[model samples]
Target: MSSANLDQLHRSTLGVYESLLDQFNPGLQRLVALGKTYIQAFQALSSTSEEYFHALGRMGEQALHTLSSRSLGDVIIQIAESQRRLTNELDGMFRWFHSEVLREMENNVKLDKDFIAGSRRRYEMEVHNHASALDRQQRRGHQDVVEYTHFLRDSQKDALKEEERRYRFLAEKHCNLSLTIAQLMNKMGGALHQRAEEWGDCVNETRASRPRTPSRMEQMGMREEERAQQWTKREEPSLGRVPSRGPSPVLMRSRSGSLGDGLGGGRLMRAIVSCAPSPNPTLLDFSMGDAITVLVPEPRNGWLYGKGQNSPRQGWFPASYVEPLDQAPRPPLPRGTNPFATVKLKPTVTNDRSGPRAPGRII
Candidate 1:
C-alpha cells in the first residue's frame, strides 16, 4: 500500500477503536456519577445522624417548657420524619445505582474469555522454548563449552527465569480478574434478587394513590381477638414449665450498686467518664486510646467535683491536681441552670418498681 493510504488506514482503525470504547463510556460515566452520589448521600447521612442527636439533645433542653403534652409528640414526629427522609434517600440512591450501574456492568460488559486462553497458551509456548534452550545448553560440546560455557548457561538460566516470571505474572493477573468479575456478578445478582423480593410485597401502590379505609365492628372485634390471643399466650403455663415460688432468696448486687446479671462492668474498666459541656464533644478517640487522660465528673458530697479520673483505679483525685486537658470537655452545667437540659428524654422509668422520677439521664 502507498504510505498515504497506510496512514489513512491507521487513522481509520484508531477512530474505530475510539468509537468502540465510546460505546461504554456513557455507562462508565453514569457508574462514576452513581458512586459520587452515594458518597455525597453517605456524607449527608452522617451529618444528619449528628443533627438528629443534636435535636434530641435540644429536646432534652426543652423538657421543662411543655405548653401541652402534644408538643412532645410533635418533636418525636419531627425526629421520625428526619430519620425517614434520610432512609428513603439512601434507599433511592441504592436502587438507582443497582439498576443503572451495577446491573448493566454485570450483564452487558462482555468478557473475552478467548483472550485469557490465548495468553495462557502463549505463556506456555514461551516456557517450553526456555526449557528447550536449557536442554540444548546442557548438551553442547566441550570444545565449544570451553569458550562459551558460562555465557550459554547464564543466558539459558536468565531466559528460563524471565519466561517463568512472565507466565506466573500473567496467570495471576488473569485469575484475579476472573475472581473479581465473578464476585461482582454474584453481588449484583444477589442485590437484584433481594430487591425483586421486596418489590413483590410492595404491590405497586404509590403513596400518592393508595386508598385509606376505616373499619367498623368486624375490624375492632378481630383486633380484640388478636390481643386476647396474645394475652392468653402470656397467661398460659407450659406443660413443662416450673413456676418460681417468689423473689430469689439470694441477693445479687455488685459493689458499685449494680445488678450483676451477666451485664458486667467491663465497659467501665479503662473508661474515663468526663463531664463535658454539651454543644459538641469528642466522644472517643481510638487514636488516643490509652494516652487520653480525662477529668471525670463526680458528685463530690453533692458539690459536683471533676478531677483526673484514673478509671482503672477505684477512686478519683483532687480537682486541683487533675487538670482538664485542652482536648477534655468542660463539665455540663447543672440541670438547674439549663432548663432545656433534660427535655424530651425517653422516660427511663421501669415498671418493675414504682418510685418518684429521678434527675438527669446517665450515659
Candidate 2:
C-alpha cells in the first residue's frame, strides 16, 4: 500500500477508536455514578438506624429518671446499652466500606479509563506527526531529505504499534472491576450480618434476663392458695405442709409470755447444740452440743431468743444456729442453786422477749 493510503487507513481507525472511547466513557462514568448512589442510600439507611438507636437510648434515660426504683426501668436501660453497641459496630462497618471498598472502586475505574484514553491519544498524535513529516520531506524534492523522513516514519510507526498494543490491552482490561467489587461487597456484607446478628443475640439475652410479669388469673389464684396453705402449715406443722415465710402482723402482737398456737414458737423444743461465740452481748454464747431452748422455729431478721437449758444464759442468737425439735426437751430438774430452775417460770421472761437483735452484719 502507498504511504498516503496507509495514513488514510490509520486516521479512519483512529476515528473508530475515538467513537468507541466516547461511547464507553459515558457507560463507565454512569456505572460509577450508579454505584455511588447505591452506596449513599446504604449509608443513609445505616445513619438512620444509628439515629434510631440514639433516640431509644434517650428514651431509656427518661424511663430511668421517671422510674428509677422499678424493675421495668432497669430492663429499658439494658436495651439502650445494647442498641448503643450495635450502632457503634454499624458505624465502623460503614466507615470501612466508604474508605476501603468505595474509594478503591473509584480509583481503579478512573486509572483504567485514563490509561486507555492516553494511549489512544498518544498513538493518534504520533501518526499525525509522521504523516506531516513525510509531506514536508516530499515537498523539499531532495532524495536524502525524503530518505531521512522515511527512516523517522518507520521509527514512529514502531512506536505507534507499541502504543496501539497498550491501548488494546487496556481496553480489554476495562470494567474488570465487577468481580473485584463483588468480592469486596460480599466481605463487607458478611461482616455487617455478623455484627447485626451479635446485636440481636445481645438484645435476646437482655430480654431473657428480665423478670416476667404475672399475666394470668390462674397464676394469681394459685399464689393466694399457696399463701393460705403456708399459714395453715406454720400454725400446725405436724400436718406436714409448706411453712409460712413469716408471722402475721395481727398474731405478732400477742403480749402473753407464750405466743398463740398459730405461731410455731409457743412450745419448748430441744436445742440444735451448735452455737458460735458472738462478739455482741445480746447474742447467746454456748459450747458446741450444749442444750438450750428455742423461742422461734423460723427466722425473724435471722435471730431467735431463748433461755439456756440448765444455765441462766438467755439471749438472742442467729436462727441458722438452731431448728425446731421434733420432741419436747426434758425440763431442768428443779434445784436450789439455779435462778430459772422452774420450767413454768422460764417462759415468763423469755417468751415476751423481742428486744435484742444483731446488727445487719450478722445476717
Candidate 3:
C-alpha cells in the first residue's frame, strides 16, 4: 500500500506542477487549494486500494476452502484451478506496475531512453544531424559564390585581352592610313613642282618672244609666286600628320593597365567609404560603410574608378572619401594632385570605436 503511494520527490514535483497550473488562470483564487485537495485525495487512496486488493484475495481463499468438499468433487477442482490462474495474473500485474511506474519514479528523468523518437537523447541526435546539414548548406553556398567570382574574373580578363587586341589592330590600321596619306601628299607636291618648272620655261620663252609685253609678264610672274606661297602654307600643317597620328604607348595601355593588374589585384584592394562622396553625377554615390571594388588603382585627376559592392553604379569618385580595407589607411591624396582639396573634409580628431564611451548625463 505504501509502495502504491507516490514518493517524496514525485509528490513535490506534483505540487510544483499544481502551482504552475494555477499560475495564469483568471477564474479563482482558491484554485491552488483545490489542486492540493486532489493531491491529498490521491495520497489517501493508497490505504483503501490496499484493503480492496487484500479483501479480494481473502474472499477467493475462503471460497476455495468452502467449495473444496462440495456436492461435486469436479466443482472443487475447477475452483482451485481458477484461484491459481487469478494469483498468477495478479502477480504479473504487480511486476508490470512496479517496473513501469514505481521504478521509473526513482530516477530524475521520468522516462528512460527507449532509443526511439521522443527521447531526449534521440532529440539531441536529431538536432546534431540538422546542425550538420545546415553547416554543409552554408559551406556549399560559400563555395558557389567563390566559384562564381572566379568565373566572372576570368571572363573579364578574357574580355580585356580581346579589347587590347582590337585596339592594337586599330592603331596599326591608323598608322597605315596615315602613311598612305603622307605618300599621296608627297607625290602630289612633286607633280606640282615638275609642272611649275615646265610652265616657267614656257613662260620665259613667251616673254623673250613678246618684248612689248614685259609688264604683263611681270604681273603674271607676281601672281604665280603669290599662288605658290598660299598653296605651301595650306600643305604645311598636314606634313607632320604621320608621326602625330601614329600609335602612342600612353593611349595603348590606357585600357589594358587600368582594369587589369596582378594576381594580387583589384578584387583584393577594396575602397571602403570612410565618408560619403558628394552628390555629383560624375562621382559614384555611396554611403559610409559601403565598399567599392577598385577597378583602377592609378589616380587620374584625384579620381578613381570602382564598382560598388552595395550598389550597381561604377564611375570616378574623389579619392578623399575612401581608404583601403585590407591595408592601413593612406593619407588623403596629395594637395597638388588632389583637385578636390578645398571640398575634401579634413579630420581634426580621431576616435577608435573601441575607446570607452560615456553615458550621457543630460540636465
Best by lDDT: 2
Q: Which ten-residue region of model 1 has the weakest summed lDDT?
A: 241-250
Q: What is the lDDT of residue 167 in candidate 1?
A: 42
User: How far out, in Å, is residue 131 in model 3?
Assistant: 24
Root-mean-square deviation of each candidate, in angstroms?
30.0, 20.9, 53.9
Off by over 4 Å in 1: 1-10, 18-65, 72-76, 106-363
> CA lDDT, every prediction?
0.42, 0.56, 0.46
TM-score per candidate, chains pooled: 0.23, 0.32, 0.19
lDDT of 2 by residue, 168-265 (tens): 64454443444545655576567657765765675576568764565687576656566655643464324222132334444333356456443333
User: Tens-digit lDDT track for model 3 on 1-363?
Assistant: 131221332344334323323332211224334544544564455445555556555555555565332222333343344444444444444444344433332231212112111322343454355446546867788412333334334434543453354346435644654565466457555665675566556556645665543486677666666665564456333221112121223432333465232222354335544535556555567775566765564555555556677566656665655667777764443322323334567678765676666788332
Cα lDDT for residue 212, model 2?
A: 51
Better of 1 and 3 by lDDT: 3
TM-score quality measure for candidate 2? 0.32
lDDT of residue 201 for candidate 1: 44
Candidate 1 local accuracy as lDDT? Answer: 0.42
Clashing pairs in 3: none
